[model samples]
Target: MRKADLLDELRAEIGAMSDKYSSELEKLYQFVCNSLFDNMADYQWVSIYLVEDFSFCLKFERGQTELPPVIPFGEGFMSLAAARGSVVRERIWNRTEVYVPFYHGHHLVGVLVVTGTAGGNIDDEDISLFCELASLFESKVKKCNS
Candidate 1:
């Protein structure tokens, strides 16, 4: 499916979903993971990390391999994303990866990381989609927290 179509479908699905804050956020995470994993064959891993005090805690993940439970606020690729409060894309051990930061109000929430599979590479479209997802998550989180 094209990026535009995928985003439109996601928006529609998210609108139809109704639940409590945490539950809805978890569902959103799962939806994002499954949707990206299924729609973008090149991507083999997708995760949502929640910020806790000064650390990035793994909230949800779906991929070919597992991820660590926690990472400091300023460490690794995820840290780079949080540090800049934007998207960071780089090649790590041959696979292309993109990390995006999520924010609620003026506070940093966490990060979203996506990695390519095998020799797969991430493109501009993937970055845009990830950014959009991050924005959506941030908006929902802010509303929930309020």
Candidate 2:
């Protein structure tokens, strides 16, 4: 699917799915993960990790391979994403991975990770779109905590 169309459809699905989830925030996460997995083939997995005291914990995940349930704050490349305070994309041997940091104002709230690329490499436009999605998650995170 085209980027704009995919985002629009995902947003629409999230909007329509509010009743299915506990909140709009959860609907966003659920829809995005399922939608992306359905539409984007190259992406092998989608996962969201959020801060829990001094570490990041897995809030949601789907697709191949297994992810650690917890990662200490300021540790690993996930910390790099937190440190960057934005989207971070890097090639990991055979596959490229994208990491989107989620924030609640100045606080590091969470991160979204997608493994693999659209093709051989990820597009800058795609990263921009992912950041837009991350912004949506950020707002939801803020609202949930408030």
Candidate 3:
């Protein structure tokens, strides 16, 4: 499916999910991650890191490999995105990665980390879509808390 159509479908699914299952934020995170990986070929994995005290904890992930459970607020791409309040992109271990920070009413809530498939580079379009998805997740988080 095209990117726009995919995003529309995602939004619809998320809305239905919210109506049907008023679960925790982590469940929503996992659903988004899994959906992105399953629908977007460029992405191999996705994870959500939430700010916890002095560190950003890995709250949910869906991928082939596991990420560290905890990372300092200033460390790594995801942490840096949260700290800087902007998107961060980098290439490491032969894969392109993007980290988009999630904010809820000016409060930095978490970061969404997306990694490209092996041997492939993440393009700007993919990054933009991931960022949009992060924003959707952020809105969902805000609604749940409100």
Candidate 4:
């Protein structure tokens, strides 16, 4: 499917899911991660890192391999994206990692991280779709937090 259509589908799914999984953000995160991985075959994995105190914990991940459960603040690509306060895309050896941070006011809520195979570097259109997904997730998070 084209990126635009896929995003529209995801937006609708997330909207319905926001109602169904309102109290369990982790389940919602897992669903989004799974949806992205299943819909976009090129991805190596999709995961969400939620901010807890001073660290980012692996909330939910959908992929072939297990990811680190905890990532310290100010470290790794997660930190880089958080510090930059925007989407950060980097080519890490054989993969392209995109980090999308979600914030509520000035407080960090979490991050949505998607990594795809090296050749699948995201262009402007792809990144825009991702940013939209992150925004959708962010709205849900904000509603729950409030």
Listed in order, each prediction's TM-score against the native is 0.84, 0.81, 0.82, 0.86
**lDDT of the candidates, in the order given:** 0.78, 0.75, 0.77, 0.81
Model 3 residue runs over 4 Å out of place are 1-12, 15-23
Q: Model 3: how large is the Cα RMSD against the reference?
A: 2.4
Candidate 2 collision pairs: none
| C-alpha positional error of residue 85 in candidate 4 after TM-score superposition, expressed in Å | 0.9
Write model 4 residue lDDT over 1-146, tens digit each, in one string: 78778768877887788689977877888888888788776787888888997999987888853347898998888898899889998877777788999888788889988888657655666677678877877777788888
Writing each residue's lDDT as its tens digit, candidate 2 over 52-104 gives: 98998988777764458899987877899999787788877778788899888
**Local error of candidate 2 at 124, Å?**
1.7
The best-first sequence of candidates by TM-score reads: 4, 1, 3, 2
The CA-based lDDT of model 1 is what?
0.78
* Tens-digit per-residue lDDT, 1-146, candidate 1: 77567667765664555233344677878777877777777888888888897988988887865558798776788887777788999887878888899888778887888989979868886687788778888878877778
Q: Which pairs of residues collide in candidate 3?
A: none
Give per-residue CA lDDT, model 3, range 1-146, as digits (tens). Answer: 77668767866786677556454676777787888778777777888888889888887787764468898876777767776778899888888888899888888888888888878757776777777777777777777888
Off by over 4 Å in 4: 65-67
Model 1, position 143: C-alpha lDDT score? 74
Give the CA lDDT, 0 to 100, for residue 76 in model 4: 89
Stretch of 10 with least lDDT, candidate 4: 117-126
Error of 3 at 135 (Å): 1.6
lDDT of 3 at 123: 74
Local error of candidate 2 at residue 38 (angstroms): 1.4
